[model samples]
Target: MRRWAMQAGLCLALCAGAASAAPAPTWRGLDPDNTLVIDTSQGRIVVEMRPEFAPQSVARVKLLAREGVYDGLLFHRVIDRFVDQTGNPNNRDGGTSSHPNLPPEFDFLLKPDAADAIASRASDGITGFVGATPFSASQLPRPDGTLRAAGAYCAGVVGMGREEDPGTGNSEIFFMREPSRRLDRSYSVWGRVVQGLDVVRTVAIGEPPAHPDRMIKVRVMADLPATERPKLEVMNPRSAAFAALIRKVRAAKGADFSICDIDVPSRSQP
Candidate 1:
């Protein structure tokens, strides 16, 4: 069972600009405490947390993860074209940890990154990244220029799964293998997949999958011993290579480009 039902659909077709060879990218380190290393039955998937969007939700996940509450939890309800749900201790909708429920975090106060990495523009809103998570905000800022909006539910995005009561956001969470734009502004998105999206896509599918896939072990990257920690680096959003990639993509897409089309690149740090 899942805390909330999640759905996926056929992928939307978008133009992918070809990336040309460039100088080695300048790497940015992911905050270990904010990165989740989910080693599933099939493989490992790395999720980068966005505390800026849902600090409480992020805290809840970190607490349970650090406590080993998610180990061996089944991907209880996986939809073929939709989300992969898990993290329910009782494996049911009402299942939760001893911790209290949290209020809904449907949207966050949006602020611009120091880099000029704008991805999309609408009459009133613009989309940009907060550590690889794409979010949109209003052009008409508040009197003080602090706008607010939700992040997009792009494929491979990680979100908090809640039941009927908005405050029931606790243990259960889901990974989006397919984009669910309708979920934007309705669910609390806390992270994005930085690696192993393939592992997420390979989770066995079923309402309650017979012989379902499960997480072998879930750990906050910071909790892992130095010898066990993953060495990875993400492309600096402000890097010239990244900026060039974005320019190529925006130009190739012409008027059809969107934030969803920009896949943030990462690599293992040698």
Candidate 2:
């Protein structure tokens, strides 16, 4: 019994020492420079833009949001267990937007350094974070020996909605409720919902509800009163803690794991 107690005590001491050696988790704060807040009847949905992935689309979204074009817009089409569409001032299919039609910006080629930092590897592609934004990428080796990559369409992906003519997308956007791999590299994915997704899930159901729920307001966090702006932080995907999390998740899911299965955990200040 004394030997067993000694063994237990030693194990506890070792664990305490190991815990002290481990760095405390660090969280990166939200950059209002590219953050947006969508106010709705349900609640507020926060989005973080990834201009590096889709510069033109991100520019257009920021332009429209600054002009207040997204305010008072209705979620015209919300398919159950799928994506929800909005961002049209006219609130109808095929209606014109105040902004000019933006050319398609499907994906971007990552810089060489960006390619080397890839974290999660899957049969489909590699996943990593550019800042706090989680992205899955398909890499291609260039003739010059450099690598190029395109973004993946995972859950919470903010994609520009276009008509039959793909280049016609201007002011319409859709939020993915699930991973729609079919749309990856085919649509202009510009940003992702980083907070308040529960509000997105609660968006009123409708192919077009008789009285559809509307956006109460939409503002760039940078444009809001300083004190009114949301304070949010996301887990650093490049951190040792994040790598450990991925390993634990992979161990649990085994071959079934996909990059979309992991979310960069986040918290918003009250």
| Number of the predicted model whose lDDT against the real structure is largest | 1
Model 1: lowest-lDDT 10 consecutive positions: 6-15
Whose TM-score is greatest here? Answer: 1
Clashing pairs in 2: none
lDDT of 1 by residue, 1-270 (tens): 121111011001001121225543467888998999999998999999999889999999999998889999999999987899999998756688888888999898764332125566576677777777878776554543356768889888999999987778889999998888899988899999999888999999998999899999999999889898878888876567777777889999998887777888889987
Off by over 4 Å in 1: 1-25, 113-116
Q: Which regions of candidate 2 fall more than 4 Å away from where they truly are?
A: 1-25, 115-119, 122-124, 144-146
Residues 1-270, model 2: lDDT tens digits? 754554344334323422456664556777787998899988889998888878888888888888888889999998766788998878977776776898878767654444312456544555666654556654333444233455666778788898989789888888887778788767888878888777777787788966677788988889999898887887765456676777887788887887677776788654
TM-score to true structure, per model: 0.87, 0.84
The local distance difference test score of model 1 is: 0.80
